[model samples]
Target: MADKNTQVQLARQPDGEPKVSDFQVAETDIPAAGPGKFLARNIYLSLDPYMRGAISGRHMGHSRLNQGDLIGGRCVAQVIESKHAEYAEGDYIVIESGWQSYCVSDGAAKDGVRKIDPNAGPLSAALGVLGMPGLTAWAGVEKLADPGLGDTFVVTAAAGPVGGTAGQLAKAKGCRAVGIAGSDEKCRIVVEEYGFDACVNYKNDDWEEALKEACPDGIDVYFDNVGGPILDTITQQLNLYGKIILCGLVSQYNRNDDNDFAGHNMGPFVGKRAQLLGLVVYDYYDQMDEFLRAAVPLVKAGRLNFHEDRADRIEDAPAHFAKLMSGQNVGKAMVTIGPESL
Candidate 1:
């Protein structure tokens, strides 16, 4: 029988790189499932760059975690016990269960919890391609940038979950997709697995030249994931009426609060009448059902492909998260909890 009680707690605030000292594995009495609630065993935990923002209290909107409270994010879990009418024992669901091994959920009444179709593909995919990252790519492409057929699209962090999905989505729409990744392997993956038209290695000696050569017609849509020198370079290559979807700034996540970029080259925007727009994935939550309706079929038919770098233990979450921030993860960095068979 499941003990039904126990969890890991945050021990301290991290400075720069997080150490094991920042976390504490603890045991607590599992609270009972209340009216319209269910008990769940966490099977997978999502480790995203946005979690880093939440940890530092830099995220906008309602804070998901307190200083010493359980760190909250998306997780895939199995229902162990239930008082909720919509759920049954052994049902697989996605919820905001934090880093703990178990949780009590009130069905889909809460934000981020949903009954996922386990047969859609791998259950872990509920936290990756077929989940938030996939929706992010769909909304960014369909709503924000709106790349037309044969349009030249450029995306940074091309090997990561959102970027990889975005690149493939662009290709599916008959657009010329160019990806920018940190290493040669990731660049190759973007071209081969994601079907990107071209890939540029940001770490290469002539990255700017390579980008220019690949995008001869200039960039029609720029999906900005890693900002810094790449943003500056992409800004200079915008075609007339080009659009840039600002997804994230992983490149600046570790910067000191004092430092700021100034005097960015805006000449391309002015000359080409291009627009750079910021996009927070949650803003498009209203269209999530629409996105899932479209994307899930592709996933089910094996048309869409995705990758995950799984860390076997929940205790390894912080390290995996650090790797994600450092561009060390090739795809979605997720931590697997409990048994693997689930």
Candidate 2:
């Protein structure tokens, strides 16, 4: 076992988009499992856009971070030492381990620790497709929108886990799945890999027209991830009585001031009779088993797919996160902390 645990810490709060200088790497004694606690070495750390707001206390239910605090995140880990009854040595689990090599937890529900099923899929996938992002997609598609066969389902951030997965799920339900993405590469990945009907590159000046061409039947369901003027633009194309699942706001996550957020006009929504359902993944934690039961088989069959953009080590987390916030990462962004197995 290593003598020290290497961790990424907050050096300073970011002004707008985060920079590598906002983080510092440090070494500390590897934590020991105390009474009713377990110690696990992290193997994969998930980097998400939400952490940008989380560290700054801009995200819901998150406190502002202080200097020297471990950067908060989720990780796939292996339990090496345990005094807890529910977890034992060699158990593969996902937990709120933050951006570090090792973590100690009391097997608490509040910690969001979940044992892994090696048979389900890749361990790293527990942090991506078959994990929280996938669950969020499932909830939005299955629970809220519930688009009918041949209904038009359009999603933004189409190459991301939530967007890609939502599009695929809607496609499987026989809905025409159209994706709107930032780049042509992302559009290709969403259309070719995730099997969306068509993908529109939002960066193109003619993209909204392209979206209109793709969804000639009219958009019945809109799975929104990036909220901005784009949301308003898309709403103009939504069919009467359409549904909108408000999943994420990546566009506003890096804003240094709240006033920078653009306000939406409700007049259009009132005219369209659109049903806006806000999504918060925390509300669906209990339905994880139900999600995995449906997702695992599709994942194994290659029907549901995912891509990853990863860094070699924990020290790269800040850079990777910066890339994600800048809308540069092509897929799910993560860091490898340790080998999957010892």
Candidate 3:
């Protein structure tokens, strides 16, 4: 077995989007677990847009990062050693293992760390389709937006993990799902792979007019993942009592120094009388079982589809993360820390 002390640390505060220089790889002596403690080795590190907020110390509820601190996020790992009764050696688990190769946890008592089924498709799926991103799409569309059959539903960042999943779920619910993405290729994938009724490329010159044309009946439900011009455009076409689920704001994540949305066009919000809501997937953890029960079958039966954009090594995390923030990645972006086999 490899030595357990190796780890990575946050090197500095990111100015705009994060760069490789902001991270520092380190090696330390692994500590033995005391009673009720366990040791885990990270296998897959999830690359998410929210991590961009965490890196900048701009998060609303939690305290921001201090310089040179360990940068942390969700990861799938295997327990290599265990002093805790609930966990055993060789158990595959999900935990807040950070960007490091190994982690120490106080078993199930810790905020993170749950045993995952190794038989489940790919281990990385725990961070993508079967994990937080998937749950976000399911819950946001089914419970929050409550899109009905034949309703015109719009989703921004449409080719991304959350947006793609949301579009599929909306279609499964019998709605006319419209996807808005940055590139023409992504727009095509959203329509062809995810079954979106229509896709609009936000990078196009007549994108706004195209969006208006696509949703002639007005948008009954809007899933806002990129909240700059896309949100502005969608709001303009919202129908009465339209539901808007706010998932993320990737359009502004790269602008860490700014505190203003002065450039946003907010004229549509006033006119539409739409309902806009911010969603954090963790708040609905209690519904995870319900989500899994519903989603697993669909995924197993091929009724639900998910895609992944992956970088090969842990060292590539910062770069891959930047791509996600820049809207350059389609579907869920992930970093492989060690060997590919789970």
Root-mean-square deviation of every model: 2.1, 0.8, 1.9
| Regions more than 4 Å wrong, model 3 | 108-110, 263-267, 340-342
lDDT of 3 by residue, 64-117 (tens): 676667777789888878998889988988898787777888965344777788
lDDT ranking of the models: 2, 1, 3
lDDT scores for all predictions? Answer: 0.82, 0.93, 0.81
Least well predicted 10-residue stretch by lDDT in candidate 2: 107-116
Candidate 3 lDDT trough over 10 residues, lowest sum: 258-267
lDDT tens digits, residues 130-224, model 1? 88888899889998888889999999989888999998888888899999999998998888887788999989899999999999998899999
Clashes of 1: 0
Would you estimate the TM-scores of all the predictions? Answer: 0.93, 0.99, 0.94
* Candidate that would win on lDDT: 2
Error of 3 at 315 (Å): 1.6
Evaluate model 3: give its lDDT: 0.81
Ranking by TM-score: 2, 3, 1
* lDDT tens digits, residue span 1-342, model 2: 778999999999998999999999999999889999999999999999899999998888889999999999999999999999999999999999999999999988767899999789999999889999999999999999999999999999999988999999999899999999999899989989999999999999998899899999899999999989999999999999999999999999999887888799989888999999999998999999999999999999999999998999888888999899999999888999899989
Residue 181 deviation, candidate 3, in Å? 0.8
Best by TM-score: 2
| Number of the candidate with higher TM-score, 1 or 2 | 2
lDDT of 3 at 176: 92
Steric clashes per prediction: 0, 0, 0
List of clashing residue pairs for candidate 3: none
